[model samples]
Target: MGCNPLHALYLGAFLPRPPPPLPPPGGKQDRARAIEAAVMAHWRAVRDWSPSRRMIRLASPDQEQEEEKKRDLPRNVVVEAVQHLLEWGRQRDQVRGEKHRRNEEGLRPPPSSPQSPSGGSSSCPKAPCSEASQPASNSQPSSGETSEILNQESVNSSPAELDSGVSEHTNISSKEKTPSGLSNPHSQKSEITVNERFLKDYNNIECIADGGFGCVYKAHHLLDSTQYAIKKVKWAIGKEEKVTHEVEALAKLSHENIVRYYTCWTGKDIFPSEDSDSSSGEEKLHKCLFIKLELCKLTLEDWIYSEESTKNYKDDAFEKFQEILKGVAYIHEKHFIHRDLKPANIFISFQNIIKIGDFGLVTTGADDIPVKRTRKKGTKSYMAPEQVGQEYGNKVDIFPLGLIWFEMLHRFKTKSEKSKRWEDVRDGRFPPEFIKAFPTEKSIIKKLLSKEPSKRPPAAAILRMLLVHLFRSSSI
Candidate 1:
């Protein structure tokens, strides 16, 4: 029976590609199957294309009109169906997470195990400052140690990630069908047998940092001796689209204050596996991705502990922070919320300019929707009040940047001094000298660290206020 489609052909192809036309005339059974396959393959090339793109591709205007005749279902209904399916998956994942949590909680403590005697634990595992209501403990660790504690979350290729305006499955024609990256267990400090060709690409590789995903190395480009940071990770086979999307999204971000992303490529069997007995030799030859980025002299963490933070450099730090803010403003403008913003992620170039790096934990930004996020997404000590598995917004990044601002401006003579004042400053309690000197900036930082995400001004607004402050100061 021949059925006519409902009148929404353009919208139908958006949520998913509509079915292709009936196979061309072919009498043989195998011939019909091949024809049908070819028709579907033709449609695949046009999948997810916009209406304008689809129209441009059609040789005759009536082609789409004829195509519309084949679909019987309403376009709105198809959209609804996709939304329902997405929601169902979300709920299913939540159910599984709850079950796993219960199982872990119900496990009886072993003798001599360090499980708390009271059997009371925060919902966030290993979270030193998970609860917003509770007072911060005096024994909080440095940001570097917190990074190590939360490194477990670093391995996840996709953790409730939501991005817009980027295609996950962008066709890398030459490399699409080829094999890339390694087996999962390769991040365990295992022996790496890098290809001789790969070695020739770089020189003087030094391990700068390591996490669950793998290591970030500082290397000199063999061709020009230009220093760069190369982040290595197993090519996430199942989630290559998401991985590629992450790379593509950041690559569009072209700002001097933000770290420059040079390129990303798959190293097919270039990093050979060392483990022999566990898997076949062919499996060991999987690929890995090498992300080349601009290398800088040191991090904001190293800057905080320096003597320059004491007295004379307060104005200089403020100026430098404005540059950092510009970078963050650009990021937010492009709709990327840096979920794991902290001092260590902010790099100080050899020229003394601050550049933001480590886009390893970005989520959807500047959105009005409030949705549940992955619980273990950030370093605990620097996490926003709403970041403990609750619905949050772009202000989560603002909170940590407030902390960074305070660290850069304040005079912390020792580790003991920093620990003693961490909570007080975090809560907007400013020292008399600080309040006297930088009252305007203090108020700005206070608003940035506000408990409510809505209360924090967007980066653009803050930059405007900073300019006004500078203008008034110069006139005075």
Candidate 2:
């Protein structure tokens, strides 16, 4: 997303340009102005796509055509349309060039490199600021520490919230509140609103990244004032009422390794939509929403995929991933599988702790829907066999996590081969020797990578065994 800072710079260049002159009222002038405004507005919609390109298609094209037929544009709307055209032309040119470059190069670029967090590129170092040296405290930790504590806090607070809410299953315990993060006061304010309910007894700061589905900002608590990551998701995509469900699921989830959801809020107000119209659309608006929590710095994928780190830790990314597994094990305990787990979704905090993030694709033990849906979800390369082909359960997550683990542990990238899917992982594609080192847990890993969903270990069971093994190993 930030792979090129030039994109923002280019967009900035055109932003200051004056819109085309408006025609005088009535007669052919009004009609000509109206047609021009409509065309400009349509062009702008394609230019200001959220995060990346796909969002422009969200609006009903048929609706656009119908509206175009009856456009009696006002001067203000014409100005907006012209402004959009200026911006769109610049953006389209930039994207086309980048696409050309990518085609020439064999590999595609990673989204949003650290150098350019706002969809730009910079020659910045991978380690922006060194790890904060404050001793781990009870109240809140650094971004990395916050990741570990978030789930713990969620588990702790879940009981009270769940008591009043309607739920599909009663098996969930109330003891699941993810810990709150502490945000730096010096950070900039986020464009998106952080619900006061979620910010209760906590501190928050400016948002750094806003993707298509959600936005990420830095925040902290009032008590500790430690900085953490706050993610608010756009609710206008499909389901309106499901925002609370996401927040609740986050509230009940806790694990030292898994990124935690501190609190969530959904209310009617002016909010940003994922498919907001660039032209003739006001920014300070709202519809419905939900927010999640965690503490993180960057992702393992960012570290590995970036040219910034290519000269640095290409060899040592494996050990970094093992640390990630420790956290993944923690999440599996509650029987929740992070279906959308990936490098970008995984975050590192101030403490350099690995926290699994993005529970949008999470699936639970209770769902009876054949484990697989027709629509494919999750990252392509890291996807499990069942996720790619058949229906599945929690084990689907384990496969990708394991691939991430393998990449991080071995510091090896998964070679893209047309036929090398998860189904064929057993035959040298994913060597058995990788899992053989950990005797007791090796079976679990193998089962997790199994072609058959029924053969894999449940998240809860995996959590217990890994924690026990990690503890036993640490004690020795």
Top candidate by TM-score: 1
Instruction: Give the per-residue lDDT of model 1 (tens digit) for 181-214.
Output: 1112222232343634446566566778877665
Candidate 1 ranges beyond 4 A from true positions = 1-197, 235-245, 268-287, 308-312, 367-369
Per-residue error at 53 for model 1, in Å?
76
lDDT of each: 0.63, 0.52
Any idea how many clashes model 2 has? 46
**TM-scores vs. true structure, each candidate:** 0.54, 0.45
Candidate 2 yields a Cα-based lDDT of 0.52
lDDT (tens digit, per residue) of candidate 2 on 155-233: 1122111222311111112122232222332232334563545445445456677766666767665666567665666
